[model samples]
Target chain A: MKDVYFMERDPYAPIRHCYGISKILYEGKSKYQEIQVVESHYFGKILILDGVVQFTEKNEFFYHEMLTHPVMFAHKNPQNVLIIGGGDGGILREVLKHKSVKKAVLVDIDKDVVEVSKKFFPTVACSMDDPRAIILNEDGFKYIQDYKNEFDVIIVDSTDPVGFAHVLTTEEFFKYVFEALKEDGIYVGQSESLHYHLDIVVRFQKALKKSFPIVDLYTTVIPVYAGYWWSFSVGSKVYNPREISREVDVETRFYSDEIHKNAFLPPNFYQKILNGNFKY
Target chain B: MKDVYFMERDPYAPIRHCYGISKILYEGKSKYQEIQVVESHYFGKILILDGVVQFTEKNEFFYHEMLTHPVMFAHKNPQNVLIIGGGDGGILREVLKHKSVKKAVLVDIDKDVVEVSKKFFPTVACSMDDPRAIILNEDGFKYIQDYKNEFDVIIVDSTDPVGFAHVLTTEEFFKYVFEALKEDGIYVGQSESLHYHLDIVVRFQKALKKSFPIVDLYTTVIPVYAGYWWSFSVGSKVYNPREISREVDVETRFYSDEIHKNAFLPPNFYQKILNGNFKY
Candidate 1:
């Protein structure tokens, strides 16, 4: 069989796969753009929604934890937050756990993903109907561009950097993130895998480094991702992502202050990339 | 579809997985018991070798790297070393890179894995036919039980605790390991995933804690196994795994002293486990 490339675009990150079709799970508008377990030669069951991989037999928690915690922990008093492209509500659920975060705004291009997640992935992506959450069916890039410094923390929970989500990984989008944040605002977005998308990660790092004074890259293990381990390039307007405290009020299954401190400890292979000795 | 369970009895550890046929990659013997991939609705890919996963799409490298590097780097002079159950030769390739390591002995139950890895995974599992290496098709458990404290370093590069490998993760086997160490001998092995298999990891940890005075747990990112982030438990008789001098002799695509040190930073969840809380 020959390889076929599949791309799922969200504002946060996009998933790209090259595989022959052996099976497809679910496909329709049910709250979320849901798809069932397909015939995956590498991984068994792959769950997709609105072109984004929601679950797999392998690993998913790493991506969920890394995407939510660092920025949430960095903000000392993140009362209001905005999540662009997280229709599945995983980020919203994580944000709601922070007692200090009184309100959240989730903007997604598609409403089908939200509906699907509400039905299937209730435990993880459950904050869809939270009292503190405001769901907006809109374009995240344009939404941020039109908004002011109104958010304490802004998380771009989009798909990969291609198709609709392509612009979100650029310096132009980060400028909007900076403009959309409070003075001490912090931003986190989906950085691709180091193994498969090394060049893309390097480009994002460069763009974020130029846009923000303090930018750091952290990674997690995600089975369905091109590379099992996925990275996030973080940019902050005022604070350093390094200053971690034991003052987190959120109850998380995977994150803690110790993890917050440990996340910054990049592998030497990655250290070489940060030090400019290694490129892609 | 009915679920089928497979057991991978590496000389070190043994792992069992329940999977659908879609999860099975390759079966039967070629150069190695090469299994491509199998999907699990819950666990991800069940990478079977002779009906067991030698290297799944998930947490295989965490075990492989941790078992090879700590002891290889800790010794001031490691001229000769013995590896039991690393049939895939991933560890052999890592050991060969240390210019100080002149000879490496790899003992495996199946020769098919070694031969197949020599063909497919040539990068990490390369150097199968190197001049400085010896491939032994024998029972590693018996081999260790017979050999006295002769080698500088001995690595347990086996599978999980399922079938034949179940003996390798026991106290009695570790006693054999202790006997097979030099005055300053070091040993490392694949414990289990800190996320899903903490019960096994804790059992392995408790067993090693009794055998060796110094026992530590470290982690790395592996996406294809049960969990994305995987942990390895290390046991030392006299040397500390963290006392690494930043001097690296061999060029590496992945492993390094810097990477070596970071691997020991257990996540906070696992930190609680090591601290005597095995709740997760």
Candidate 2:
């Protein structure tokens, strides 16, 4: 007998991926979305929300390190950091690596995701007990409206632009994010894939450009993701992401000084993407 | 009713990908391998050989450009080029763009794959009619043993190290390739993915290092391939592939001057990979 678990990336398209499920660890419905945790033969512990893969223990470091470190290292002195929609605590783990970070606050809409992650993904959720860490069980969209120039670095580690997370990609929401960040604060988020989600990246870049002084895009390959060339969008008020201002002293599997310099897309290719002339 | 075509990347591991096939253009078995062409809703026309996807019309440029141009431009003057196992003519098309090239030779074991590509993939196979092109239906292993110091550049565009193509990755075969090249000649081939096929890459690099003076590795992202981050192994005699020696005069969708510099993996990461310490 063979066991297979398939996840459809898009309902309208005929593309799907499957993983050999060794065991089903947890399954339930949160107030916001469906949650699932499973053990796989290849990727180890896997987390799924609303039928989309969030992270796997095998390669979550690529996504978490690329998402958090680029923007964190780009800033000069990041003390107060705000993370939106990362209940899995992977982002929190990477943020706490910086010694200069005095406070790290995470606001997530789903409390069940945190509980499930703490139970199944203990390594990723280990940093939640740190004294400098703060967890808020509230909607990120509603929580950011109250913050005004309170953070040195704001990282939005949200899901795809669908369901309850849809508003997180809009221009109005970015305006609130811009206002919530300090005058010299930096912001970064998971923008989506350059293969299948170029439109979303372009829309988010346009919205971010309207509120920030400098905006750029970088990419890293995540094997289990639907589109392998995962992208991230960065917006800065006074710093340039191309130059790393701080020393990387943390122990990492993928992030490095040379990778930080080479991760950004080429200027010509980025211009084509911005002009909507990118072939694929 | 729904139409679906699934391709399992590995038999031992439970990982598979599928595409919604709107139409099947051709399906037949040759003396070498099984060939199929299908019209996909998202990827347009896709070519599959022996249940593995070779390329798709939507993103073939990423693979072809990355495979052909890095070595082509790295050399001072590539007047004569030989491509082994590229029956689809995509690599041939990119090679013909340089006016300095006087002859382009392509050899493949499967004649049926060439016929199917010319008929179903006309755009990619367009350069077959060029006066400078030569096509041979013969096995690459036996054909290269007779040549010595013949070509300026030799590209082994063969499939994965399986079935009839398995001999192409052996040390004795690379010895023949080293003898078949000029004093400063360059050699490059499609190495497997870094995510799943790292062992094959490590083995191939070890084999190539015995014959060539300088061996390097680079990567590109192909969305439809089983592993998105595809690797390429290059062996050079004199020139360093990290620097471009000539100007790129061809029109391309993905390859650029800046991309040539950024496409290679960072030295630190490559060292980790060579040391067998890469976690992901």
Q: What is each candidate's fraction of native interface contacts (fnat)?
A: 0.28, 0.86
Instruction: Write one digit per residue (lDDT tens) for candidate 1, span A142-261.
Output: 889887879999998877777677889988888888888888889999888765566787889888887788888877656455455677888998777867633877676566777676
TM-score of 1: 0.78
The per-residue C-alpha lDDT of model 1 at residue A160 equals 71
The numbered model that scores best in TM-score is 2
Tens digits of per-residue lDDT, candidate 1, B122-214, equal 554667878999999888888888878778888887766776778999998888888888878888887767655668888898899888987
Candidate 2 docking band:
medium
Which regions of candidate 1 are displaced past 4 Å? A1-27, A30-47, A50-52, A56-62, A119-131, A223-226, A265-268, A274-280, B1-48, B51-66, B111-132, B223-228, B274-280
Docking quality class, candidate 1? incorrect
lDDT of candidate 2 over B1-280, digit per residue (tens) = 1567655464322357787778888989999888889888888899998887888898899999999999999999999999999999999999999888999999988999899999999999999999999999998999999899998899989887888888999999999999999999999998888887888888888999999999999999877777778889999998898889888888888898898988998999898888888845
Residue B41 of model 1 has an lDDT of: 47
